[model samples]
Target: MKGNKGLIFLSLMPWLCMEADAAQHWADTSAGVRWSSSFREPYNPEKVSKTILNVTHVSQDDYGRNFLFMDYYISGMEDPSKDNATGAEEFYGLYRRTLSYNALAKDPIDSSWVKDVHLSGRMDVGYENTQLSPRPFKVRMGGLVDFKIPKGSLEWGLEGVYQKSYNGITHRHFEFDPSFVTWMSWNYPVTKKSQFSGILEYLEAIGEDGFGNDTKPLTIFRANYIYDIGQPKGFKVGVGYEQFNNKYSSNNAADPTNGSDQKTFVLLGSYHF
Candidate 1:
């Protein structure tokens, strides 16, 4: 994992250096960090928990009449279950790149019935070593289309992703054919510093094979209400609810369930600089 991360950094060196010149033409860059915790009830009898520390950087530039944007996320997770025996937990790393363009650059943002369209392609690679497996690697390729209609404060997007995996342990063979995902979201402001947003998405694995047979499609729905905590500093807080439905192929001795449903309540705090 370390070696692969090093290689990925080296490959992006040229582009990183070009940022200095690119800034002069047209570009914006920002970095932020986030921490999140997830909980499961039945499957995690002891309240099994994990922590994720993430850092994200994004850049956008304009070349002639086209637009370009790039985003990067680095995350590390700490698994409490794996720290029992060896007193050591595993860390995962991921690298992703995206290139995109705008389809309606000539239209004015305030024009009536005007629309903005964007098309993007992305690649992601990740590595994780868990208690059950020595080393696991996954690769995914995907494309997305985004549409923005400012007149109604609406945004929609569609995405298709294909993933392949290679397992390093014998009994833990894993494979996934392909998956398709689509989501639509809308934003509405109710007060001077408060807003509401809702999103619905469907994700499914296309076929059954190897470990893929054990995984099934998922439907997720989420709603959030956000309020500004500080007016001058740009700090905000959000409360949300999410629901999920997932199914597995066969039941194991430890866990035997064809399908399960869960609902989660989340609280988030963020500061923008």
Candidate 2:
């Protein structure tokens, strides 16, 4: 993925129009570090202690909304890097855009419990230097519905996309397969200075992977309780729990001893500006 810099630029071209046509609503950038001891990679038996540096941005405009986030997994051993004798690092980035149906339509659908709908798109790109050396890129097209709740809201989305991968070691492309994705997200105010939020996402199986292993549906769930420590400056601290199953589409029929399913608690701190 690092070598295909041009493709990254081309993929992001659609977002460039926002600056010219959209009126700014609200935007926030946040940085955080999270640590977990149960992080797993496919086929690996060891549950490694992972340190992740995260950067995120969320914004909304009169027309729609956008979310962009990146994660950097840090290593402290002398494993992958030779010159500096550092550990291997992995990176993943994602961007999502939603065009509001209510804002664009002259006659929008409205009900007591339904808020709005959106046409949504998302792009996921990732690279890892571990044994599989997988480089994944996916694009999803879908629709989302926002439903009004008593004190919060629920958002549900579904998408269809094809997964494409490049093998760094083999210098070849993997078999292309179609997949479906769906997710539900929600937030509720726990207090004036705190909130409870979570997202549960599922990815349907896309048959065999590059390694000739049968793939299974994947599930990822995360919940967080956050407090605004610096309300004036938008600083926050939070704790989270994450549950992942059949990570990276690994076959569930394989050994349970393999670190394919993981549940872990995370420590998080972030500053938004």
Candidate 3:
């Protein structure tokens, strides 16, 4: 997967768009850490009541913006019902190339609705357990659109997801199977040092479950309220809530077709350096 960069870029063809206008170099970089409780995931039949530590990074360059996060589960050993096994590690990242809104539309339409767009790529890699995701990697490529609001921005994106089966091969290869994924996001400044943000996503799966069954579409939601802690916004704190309508796997007790509903509370902090 490390050397298959060409294949990944080609897979993004349908979702690609124009490039951003900026200097051709790195712009900003930052790192931070966080913790969340009672997290639930697609593979879990129920909530994995545990504490997890997350290390994260963010970078912006002339080409686009990128984000990376690594999570290590702690406190899942005593809970047999947890989807997150003890010591499980998970990683995910997104890289996006900003697209100029005016260039794509040449006509100079209203500035209120369309502000910007981007060609984006993303990947997720996770260490599995009986309760969480079985697939080691999931990759996606698409374009994201941004809209202008009074005091904030809204973004929507659609991507073609490439996912491999848990037992596909020795290493996860390009399934190139066309599964669907899309997201909607929002951010608004509430005050000089505070903001509100949220995201919603629809995930379509192409993996099989026990008895060789396919699961249903799932909806994931995460929302956060953040405040800058000090001068120049060097540190931050946030309170958030996250939820899933159904998991990716077919393990819902009430209705297997819909999967299980999961929710969690998140407490987070981060520093820019």
Top candidate on TM-score is 2
Q: Model 1, 65-143: lDDT tens per residue?
A: 1223222222233232233433223344444333333422564344344344444333454444444433334333343
lDDT for each residue of candidate 2 in 81-178, tens digit (9 for 90 to 100)? 33445666889999898888888899987798788998887888998776556788888878899997888768999998766887665678875577
Q: Write the per-residue lDDT of candidate 3 for residues 1-273, one digit (tens) a residue.
A: 555657876755533432233443443344555555466544344445555556566545444555566765554543342343354444444444444445455664466577667767777776544443345566777788877777787889998877654532233332434688989999888998988899999987666543355666778898999888995338888888888876654445546433267676788676755
| Model 1 bad stretches (over 4 Å) | 1-38, 41-52, 56-60, 63-80, 83-114, 124-129, 133-153, 166-174, 209-214, 247-260
Supply every candidate's count of residue pairs whose N, Cα or C atoms clash at under 3 angstroms. 0, 0, 0
Q: Candidate 3 clashing pairs?
A: none
Question: Candidate 3 at 212: error in angstroms?
Answer: 1.7
Least accurate stretch of 10 residues (summed lDDT) in model 3?
167-176
Off by over 4 Å in 3: 1-6, 9-28, 41-47, 79-87, 93-110, 129-135, 167-177, 249-259
The weakest ten consecutive residues by lDDT in model 2 span: 76-85
lDDT scores for all predictions?
Answer: 0.47, 0.80, 0.62
- Superposed Cα deviation of residue 210, candidate 3 (Å): 6.9
TM-score of each: 0.60, 0.89, 0.73
